[model samples]
Target: MTTAVPEDALVLAGGGHSHALVLRRWAMHPERRPRRPVILVNRHSTALYSGMVPGLIAGIYQRRDAAIDLRRLAARAGVALVIAEITGVDSTGKRLELSQRPPLRFGLLSLDVGAETRPSGGMPIKPLEPALAFLEAEDLEKPAGDAAPFCVVGSGLAAVEVVLALRHRWPERSLRLQAFPKRLEARVLQVLKRHRIELQPADAPLPGPSLHCTGSRAPSWLQATGLPLDQNGRLLTDHHLQVEGETLIFASGDCAVIRSDPRPASGVWAVRSARPLAANLEARCRGGSTRPWRPQRQALQLLGIPGSAPQALALKGHWRLGPFRWLWWWKQRIDRRFMAGFQQLQTMDSIDPDASMACRGCAAKLAASPLTAALAESGLRSAAQQPEDAAELLPAGTAGSSWLQSVDGFPALLSDPWRNARLTALHACSDLWASGAMVTSAQAVITVPALSSPLQSELLRQTLAGLQSALEPQGAALIGGHTLEARHPTPAPASLGMQVTLCVNGQVRRKHTGTGWSKRGLRHGDRLLLSRPLGTGVLFAAAMQGAADAEDLDRAERMMGSSQHPLLEELLREETEQEELHACTDITGFGLLGHLGEMLDDDCRLQLDAVKIPSLNGALELLEAGHCSSLAPANRSAWRWLDAPAGKAGPRIHLNLEGLPIGGSRHRALLELLVDPQTCGPLLIGCSETLAMRLESLHSWHRIGCVL
Candidate 1:
């Protein structure tokens, strides 16, 4: 079935441990980076190292110490990262329907999405999403009226950690660990014993053939999707990890129904499959048969507790130590060393441009270096682009309002492939918000470097997904877009940046435009209402250096993912009451106040109530402590101070002040709101009292204001 057309090969789906490790091994032996790989992952990074999860939960380890950093992994491996969830697969079409993309072609496919979670009925706790649940129930909103009892069911590692974590995290809440067994363990027969944790062993199962998963097991989504499954709802797979009957499609991880032998649903077996799975996929890409993957009999284990002293467990035996301060210290060393691999350190590089280093896909992708070079080679002048349709504009006859329009796009500034698309699209849509116009449609220009057909296709799919998500809510539709392959990785569309005229059909458009506005005309005491938070420039630049935390990065990502264009429309409707005059610009590489300075009239005095402006978490602190973004130096050159007793401060201006410091820990609560950037962005509706009330009522975004 392999095609000579170079378009045929295996597509490993998901960043499950097995698949993730397989990618690592494949990269290490890149004579075998799977040629037609279309790695499908729901998350950008698949939080590897589940063993340390309990230690992480117990506050024993930070998220970075526990995560694998799949972004770095994929980059090193030179693989496509299609961040999407697969809902269904059509064998007849050889296509997979992602939650976000059109049907994608797959020659030979394998899934390692992992089994979903099942929760105890009526129980407020969820075992799989333990971290989030714990944060919600115990951390954010504690028991107000009654003590909520902690009840967990299961005996395995996932269960054991939850029990101990609950005890450690919430000592005030009632602790109730209950266990009921139909039959005793075969070894402990005829012996009555008391243990801290209740042991449940049954000779006869709980009225069913399958083990009722109260722990981390198959969620309803798996059953709803209805992939080939056994009676127990486990996806049936062959010895080769290929799904039964559909050998062209494979399954791995705990979700797969590998009935050839009974195996514990442990991450160990998954990790062990790395070598075999990668080899088989590589072999398949080379037009050969897939190799067999065999699970190992045993793996070493570690038990974590949130106590002063630590207890250890493994296949070797149980060993309790007096104090694990030393043990935790040792563990920390090991974890740090393990996490070092995730740094942006590439293992391989080809010297010559036309030199082929065993490419598997249909096209040769341009390395990031060449991509940047091509973007820099653009001959366009430093002028803003204008739309040139022959339609003559009639002045708004002094009676009606008007709408404005402009367009922009750029090469991705992020290293994470999946997030790059999302952020770029978000950056592009910012123009719509800044112009105060509803985005009706978008025309795109995609430039993918020479790469495999599969890689190119996946990139295009991901790009379109990001655009669709950012635009649709504002009634914006991406109806038309053009894609071309080039010598660069930039997705810079031709529709951006040029000597262009902006046309609009609004009263203000015929009246006032983004003209005659300089630092002199802006009056003193004019209030500044930044539409979005700052720190995007700083945080993302920090991420490139691998200094940002996972939670902070995740928060930034989740915030940017939502459509900001709609928030602008909401602000416009909310601003109908007052006319302080709308004067604003969306925050971009120029940073918050840098862009704000551009909209101000010449010789005008302005006041930045360092306290009133909202900021994002960890932004000012990062900024003040010599952690400015890469764009900071460029932004500094744009400033020309006329009159400010604040001494014309630099990027850390948020912290520089005579009265209350804008970047103090006390001010962090407020600054965390103001510094976070909004993609597509919010409207800084500078109306009278209506703006504040509307923002309060909508509650979609945090509001902060200051009068200069």
Candidate 2:
């Protein structure tokens, strides 16, 4: 359910350590949360723990170990998560300008977006995501035996760890550390020498690829906000962590410095400031006073040494500890314990006990049983009578042309408004495409969430833009549409409360005498081909429970957003004219079995190769773990219609599992996937073996079964 955004919503901009901890606190202690809606805006779905960066760089930890799933955290905390790059902040207007969507207005705002590193000649080590990507790409391109010296520039512990990490990642490559002699501690210098890393003057010219761990500075975009800044351009905040002279704005982490007790930019300070930041943000939201935060002057820093037998060094203002193996273990424990705070959150499920989590997208459609019953009672032709994807609109005396029309929609599936609308447009167009017609025009009926007039307008703008993007690419014009506000807003993230419905019109070219492709023309021995993989249903269901992997969700979103025009074009290519496609339909709210049931003939039964069914990555595992779309049970009813003899109903479809393992976890999972409703799912086409083979050779289409 989507939560309505009030006029006084609190926005936390950036998923830095401090903001992440604030969310954790709210998750663990919901009673102490702010009264108003809390939203977290970040550029990515995962936040990297800075404390674990060295270990991650040295290959001591997996990427998941160091990354926090912001989506899960926000869901657990009852906060909305918006994944988008923040381009600028408007202090006077109380708005945050985003790169892709419209500007977001906030009643109270907090900034924990860590500082940016601007290196003169090398990649900046801050903003670890892109930096890590660059490093990985460089490693892949450069041979292991390359003698080129990789350089790290800085005298800080971060630079030293990065240099050592390079040594660990590429053992044969020459590694160089550029730091001033006066800035380096004796023990640190000794560790560098022991690792065979050459130390050069800070000003030394780098001969190869280099990384800069130079200290933090405010992001250039923040400068446009006209906020108070310190010597290094970091935001200036009061003792209470509130932006100086601004009561409604707060700042923390490396991005801001408390003017009363300034400290060096470090992850330690970021962690230490979380508790106080959370308290102050909550206090400000409830119309209460905030307390001042006084941080300790010195923080203990632990630096890990990467080698066969790892050790760590601890440092304070003037005190230094030994590089012992115990220290390394201790550091690992701290990092793991910190990460466990997020990982362990999986135990705290947010799903309501009394109500099942109704899915979004196509899975959210009304069940067929009730819809068919209602249509019959109203004396209207049911879908069974008109088994085609789109309705044929023939003008009274027109003999040369006929129009195909279809309307489809659902509540927003993704938090991003643009993406959700774009996918909706694609899903709506699939009907015409399934009928072997190209969309020529479309009209939309969009319902924006209940918000201020300005916010509603901004959301509508994004939705329209997304819809237009999908239509314009197919040479389809968006003629006109209607807009309204939702009566009751459900509580979820981003623009989940918004809904979109599109009515598409297309022209069908006659093949000899037939009007267009239909779903009823299946013959014996006709093979079934699927254009894309399945499992969007189960995957999204798992996502609502915070159990889906970020990578899997990312891959699923890419597939769902991709246009199916290329596949449609390929199927209708001139070379394939000799072999006709018997039937076709886009698998949607009705799962594969449900949609396939509609294509069956009285005497024919489909023989499916269970193992040949394509599923998205991690989908089978999710299914095996008992995650399924809410509509699966209703969709499973379609099994009754499968393999039935003429004038008779059979129990289920016949599976051609000759020697494969039976009743195994994977087998059951695959069976369940058949009834798992898809959102913008694949196109299922029936054709002869000759055409099937040709389509399968194209790589996108997979022949999953055949009518027997």
Candidate 3:
């Protein structure tokens, strides 16, 4: 964690091969680290090693073997990893527009996004990400010839390699190559013929899975940036890889064209360019001169052929090596060597023997008992004494309605900053909603995790963008907030991640009377309505343990990040209905039971059905399997109201809804489930039974029990 804001930032636009190599070098040598924070923006959490892509398609390498985990890589480099798609660039403003978050400001920007192949019909494999997706969907065991015929388009090394791999994977399938250039070497043609692949005419129709290995083209978004470009639309750069006439902008990989030393857009040049790119970036950050990048005239290339005893075809300058078994051995060695660098970062101290995965959202909060006690000890009762969702405030102006104010913040729960920001905003605004207030304005307080200055800026930008997107729809204006680096004297656990807090101000629709729309107004016979499901705690805990299913996590995240403003707006729409809404609160860190306990009085209690309460998918299953969040024990402390131990056969509670002991131990499992903390949790509303009946018809509202 850093204590102060960074003055400068270096942003990498894409996770191409060159950028990956540059990150690897930076991770290895902290002494050469740039003063500006280094941030890598990629579409996914990992970058696939293009070198072993053919081997991956041939089933010779595992998917993990071809992937470089960008999250792990960024952590190793002490930088920030932002997973977002770059839509375009504002060259004049030095900002990169993302597909989902706010535009990111960059002091220095590098584009190594690689290139994409635009296909007339077939699927293009040049962009790598989409190509990897296509490869993953391949069904090689479809009874070979029973499947449709496969075809390859374009006459490049990538096309040949892909065709050979496809043929090897499904030998019975009829494979055809529509080589436009028709300039493959004799040895390459021999390898193709040996696989029984037919060379089709240029006009041949593409049948089944057609792999397009045509020439690479720069992304269309780059052309609109007004950057100097070659005829092919690639950003033109000088010998030092800096964009021509733009010292702050740099380009590499297939997306860049070198004016001083023109070369084909191939993985070889991208790999070789990493060294000088890293050096020049660091030099520029330090206000020093840069060394020019010199590319090799001819680089060695290894091509893989399909078969059990596959032979490698090596080519360079005017020389071509044989289809020999020894060549395959050498090719395997070289590919493995290339991949080894990414896999060799583990040090003994980096390994932890007793590290517990801390969960995000409400699970990251301190225990309520201790927090409450500390506040009481400090005599800070203003917030505690009037603990509704939002505090009543004087109207900002005479034209404004009564004002309500609240503040909320939490450590990051998701690796994606956008998701975290959106959730945080929703979580913060839920307080205002519970108080029957319409969000008017909000200010953000962000604490970025320890990363390079550039990466921190990117993280803050994405977080605020997400928050803005989530709030704007509710008619809330984001004014401004504070940004700070988390300052830790010693290294903290990875779970103590970035945090974001939003101080929200909203307008109360109803008059600011003490009797209505307060947390203490539960009626004698009101029904308690829950707006959403529970179980974020257990689900997230399972996620940390790698025990949660992807579908289950997705369901939990969607439920947790959903907003409840609309539902509250419906309940508090009319004046008569507003009075019927006796009390309201959003279940968050306190868990359902802990928060519900706060709403109880000496004269009334809540009667809940164990099965009536909604829970996130797979939450109960994980809880039954003994998975619990780090904060579970603290939340469970409130379960003592039941007067029974957790696992003792028939635990029962005598808590009365207007004086009556409900059923016994059948609710035991649900008792534990009730205390599971929530993130963007549902609203717990106390309303008339008539209104509850009306609300029960809606999917968003659940009538869990009655308040008496």
User: What's each prediction's TM-score?
Assistant: 0.74, 0.88, 0.73
Which residue pairs collide, candidate 3?
37-452, 37-453, 37-454
| lDDT tens digits, residue span 1-708, model 1 | 232224533456667777777766654655667544444454445455666666665666666667776654654465555556667667766766667555556777777766654544434233334444444455454562255444555544455555666555655554434334432233221111212433445232322111122445533455765467765456777667767776467677776757785465667777676666666666666777676666765555544455656543333224334223555556555556655645434433322223212221101112223334555577422121211111123343433324334444444443333455555656655555555545566666766656567656655665666566655665666677566766543211111111111121211221233221112223334445555555655555445444555466566666666666656556555544234344545565444554454554443444455555555566566665445443354445433432344654433222323376544654543333233333334445343444555565676444444334
Question: Which is superior by TM-score, 1 or 3?
Answer: 1
The 0-to-1 C-alpha lDDT of every candidate, in the order given, reads 0.50, 0.83, 0.76
Among the numbered candidates, top TM-score falls to 2
9 in model 3: Cα distance from truth in Å? 1.3
Relative to the true structure, candidate 3 has a C-alpha RMSD (angstroms) of 7.4
- Comparison by TM-score, 1 against 2, better one: 2
User: Using alpha carbons, what is the TM-score of model 2?
Assistant: 0.88
Worst 10 residues of 1 by lDDT: 492-501
Predicted structure 3, TM vs. truth: 0.73
Itemize residue pairs with steric clashes in candidate 2.
1-491, 2-490, 2-491, 2-492, 3-490, 3-491, 3-492
Please provide, for model 2 over 1-708, each residue's C-alpha lDDT reduced to its tens digit, 9 standing for 90 to 100.
111233566889999999999999988888778765577899888999988988788777788889999888887887877778999998888898888567777888999888888656689997898889878877775676765688888888889988888788877788888888789989999999999999989887898888888877877788888999987888999889989888678899999999979998888899999999998877776666789889999999998887899899999999999899999899889999999989989623655743337888999988878877887788875664456689878763567656889999998887667778999999999999898888999999999877767557756877888898788889999999898888884554436788999999998754554466889898888888898899999998898877899878878988998999767777777224568888889999989988887776666678788888999999999999999998988887776653455765553368766676878888879878888999889999889988888777786688788887
**How many clashes show up in model 1?**
44
